[model samples]
Target chain A: MTIADQVTGTPIAGTADTAVRAKTAAPAITLPVVGERELRLDLFRGMALWLIFIDHLPPNLLTWFTIRNYGFSDATEIFIFISGYTAAFVYGRAMLESGFVIATARILRRVWQIYVAHVFLFTIFLAEISYVATRFENPLYTEEMGIMDFLKQPDVTIVQALLLRFRPVNMDVLPLYIVLMLALPLILWLMKWRPDVSLGLSVLLYVVTWQFDLYFSAYPNGFWAFNPLAWQLLFVFGAWCALGGAKRMSRILASPVTMWIAIAYLVASFYVTMTWYVPQLGHFMPKRIEQWMYPIDKTDLDVLRFTHFLALAALTVRFLPRTWPGLRSPWLRPLILCGQHSLEIFCLGVFLAFAGHFILAEVSGGPVMHALISLSGILIMWGMAWLISWYKSEADKSGSKTKNAVSNADMAGGG
Target chain B: MKAKVLLSLILLCGCVAASSARAEDAVPAGPPACEVPAYLLTTESQLPKTAEIIRDNKPLEILVIGSRSTAIPSSEDSSYPARLQAILKEKLPSEPVHVSVEIQSKKTAEEAASGFVKLMEAKKPTLVIWQTGTVDAIRSIDPDEFRSAVTDGVSALQQAGADVVLMNLQYSPRTETMMSVPPYLDNMRVVAQEHEIPLFDRFAIMRQWNDQGQFDLFNPTRGSELAKQVHDCLGRALAQFVIDAAHVGPAQQQN
Candidate 1:
């Protein structure tokens, strides 16, 4: 808005300058606020990323603690949900401050970040796949790669991922997250222009996530991929909880009728989950898209998953502490720091993970060597993060030109 | 034609064993009677009261014993157990039957007896169809031992208030190894005769089909139309027998 000054009468830049200062940097940790926010969002994101690393890492000693055969599902559900909560917390204010234009820019930047991460990860995945393929090529199993496969595949354009209208075989959640973030501008627009409308729309999106599972179940045997539509309700739910929390939970908690309804809703959702008999268990409910009768693909959203997610969201929002007990522990300080800077730490963690797998499991030795390598990897990533932060602070000290780097980005964007 | 004739003879012989002399027309009415081929075990069939009993509208309880082949067909839609249930319902529409054709543990008649007793007690069945000896035939146990175990099983079912019927092993061509059925089937027939229980005589049906060139007995197709033909034949027969054994009468048939 500020840069496009020629089109408007109002001084968009000046208002933005003022709003930007108030919004860019979150409040400082005086007593417990920063600590609490970090735990609420970052801890969950931090832990999920950690599990993901362990899940992918090769045979190693760390597998004992890190690998989960069937662990906390909060992996995909909590990460995206936390994304929603953070989007609501940060972007909701952006919408209020600079209006929808900057909100669009913000959503775009976030999606771009996910896109960049995916491109980088895809390159690494290919490199590893090729390396392994050369060592184990057979009719049943091949560790071979063709250049055409990479060229044809990496060509799945940004447009396809953002629309979630394309599926590249063997990919995971990066595209899904990118596609979901594309909806942020509209979400914020609705939240700003009409809070009730936006809130209702979020609820409806959640219903879509629940209703869309049946559509994808037609494939033979089956597929293990997560449906983005089915999964986004967790984020939308987290967003709602972040934006609209109330002590007025007391109103319903003590009410006998509300308690009974909650109990009944939870039991029914659980039953549906256990049985997998809901039509959405295998495919999406098609009737919803048909006004004149049309087809809407969920891609990953299935009905029971949506309901199960919602039931979990409602229960967590209704019952969980404003600040978890784990947050209060001094022993968890390093975890808290790692959690706060999760994306950066995750990049480092995954880098170390590859090194761990190559050196330990690939070395053809006993597990003791693997354990040593894993510990060394963890410490190395931790040290690398600590050193980077130290160097960045030192650079800031010598530079006399600007306000904090965090604020500089906000100012440069004029938001 | 001779095989069909012989199957019909075996079935008639089975009817003769279970039906009391006066039950030629005085048999009780139930789901068992619905299997009378709609032609043979009719209201006016000249058989014992058990035949009359099978002609009536009483619920049928069928016990199927077989291996994975019988329990779960490549197409579940045509599994023998599922087919038998369909036949009982189609024939004895007035008498909705409960069919329990369990995966009989390869041996241990003592264990198989529970499933049999439970089905009989719940449905108060007038007839049953046993399809074991195929598995026992594969893992060759002594034929006499098989007979005694099966006899004990039949005694347990009769004690549970059931009119027991055993199906003789027919043919198994697909499996690499098979237990020869001549000894097992013959022993089962003797036990059925001694206990006065009906036997389905699937051996006779398969032999007839093979001789007629409808299917080769030992090398029949994996999932052939003949299997379904034999399944329907036995299901229809069992429903009629149950109805006759229930002593259903002509007046009830009209109503």
Candidate 2:
């Protein structure tokens, strides 16, 4: 079987002799194309993006329903982990079929694209916050959104913004993504040659970052909010799973013993998280244990957070099987669409979050207002995703038509 | 080596000249009464470490961690921390002072407090001016939780050997009408009193300025220009407040 078949878990039609012959004659080797997208990745990623939007707008009542209230890991872990899985699935195939040079070029091009999107998003986000602050005659908005630097020293701040250093508030995640994407080529190469070694290296980096206090410095002050060195472990682990690690551990993944352990861990996390709402019950735990787990550092990807995320992922995969009928339900279509166009949806979500905050502050910010703003923002996101998907589909149809016509003309000329 | 020495000499001369001018500018003989309101003044005992640092001719490092409004206008020289540094330097010309601002992005007091230990370790500032309560007030976080978070943050700063000063919420006419802030403000004061740390009553001070006809904070068109003036005044008041808290005076100056 081809490496693509091995990675994607798709069965090959040809015999072992045919596969051997194809491998010897590179011209005969055809890569196994992924005809269908992974529903689980898209569904969860879309949901996580929406949750991130709601969670960012503080004081909104919608935050209560987010996964964070019931688990140690929040939407951030889900988003980053899915990002890793998707990146590996997409790019690993390129490395296998098109050769390393083409794969490196493609990855770098993607990094550049993400970098540009980040800068564009930052500019638009600043403009939005600044306009609201000025229009409402409230300078506090600038301060609240972390855009005061740009207002004060546009020259220096613009440079820092370009370098992905001066991230204001919600702008930190894109910079983290940019850094991770830049390192994807090396990660893919290592995984291609030595999967275990690649994962080991990732773990080593995370441990060193935690033990030795290593992190990239942010511009005009402190360290990066999401420390890439520490967070890369989750991203790498996701990639490993996509690159045959999941299949290698298929027995363990399906084991009843493993399933029980995941469920138990999730239940415990739920109990612990629920206590946060009830202070008395929160303190019911022993003082020493509470103190040790008091500040689970989100920036450095604390061990508790990592373990909690793994447990959550395991439980999710077990419960929400790939062929679950609900994945194709009309009710879930919007979420699936948003997940399909995640990058665009994420950018829209950031803008909507800022808009939501402004609206909450301007309006009564009561329960009714919060509900209205959240529903409106989410609908807008879904609408935009649908529009983009429609446009892409139309473009694809037109291109295919043109190709077909050209082929017919060539055949007629040969006759 | 020679270039370094020459640069150092130039810097020393510039510092002396700047200090002399600042001393001249420090005199507030003709300013309006509302500009330096009595309610803004703190009679708490001086911060021993701050005073000692100034006395030793060392650069007093002050870290101001708060919302953007309290610290922004990005011109490092115009920020409250920068203004405070200038005010302190004018008061004690021989002592070089540096103020750094760290913007708190977290909305709740607890979330803001979570970063205190990390920041304290990183910055190693002799003084930490924590501006909080605005987000919590807007969100209507539980009063008890807000109190506990403030207390924990203060305790963490103290343990890190940094003097802690809590600054309450900014007075926004628009926000005031929209949400109640009494619980958060009262809780902050109680925490301050319990911890023996001085609470900078920014909300009251701003309210007084509006009530006393010092600044028309309600004016919607002024935007950042008005904010600049208010921040400048706040920086001056905070400088004096810190100096008084530190018990630094002409007599305490290092010769």
lDDT of 2 by residue, A252-345 (tens): 8788898899889888878776554333474466656755564556778889889999988887887888889999899999988888777778
Give the Å shift of residue A408 in candidate 2.
20
TM-score of each: 0.45, 0.62
Report clash pairs, candidate 2. Answer: A143-B68, B46-B245, B46-B246, B46-B247, B47-B245, B47-B246
Report the Cα lDDT for residue A17, model 1.
57
B111-143 in candidate 1: lDDT tens per residue? 465566665666555555566665555444445
Regions of candidate 2 where Cα sits further than 4 Å from its true position: A1-35, A132-149, A362-364, A400-415, B1-255
Which has the greatest lDDT?
A: 2
Q: Which stretches of candidate 1 lie over 4 Å from their true place?
A: A1-38, A58-72, A138-171, A194-196, A209-224, A245-328, A349-361, A365-381, A384-394, A401-415, B1-255
Error of 2 at A386 (Å): 1.5
How accurate locally, in lDDT, is each candidate? 0.48, 0.68
Residue-by-residue lDDT tens digits, candidate 2, B87-162: 6766677788888888875456788888888888999999889999876654545455677999998999999999
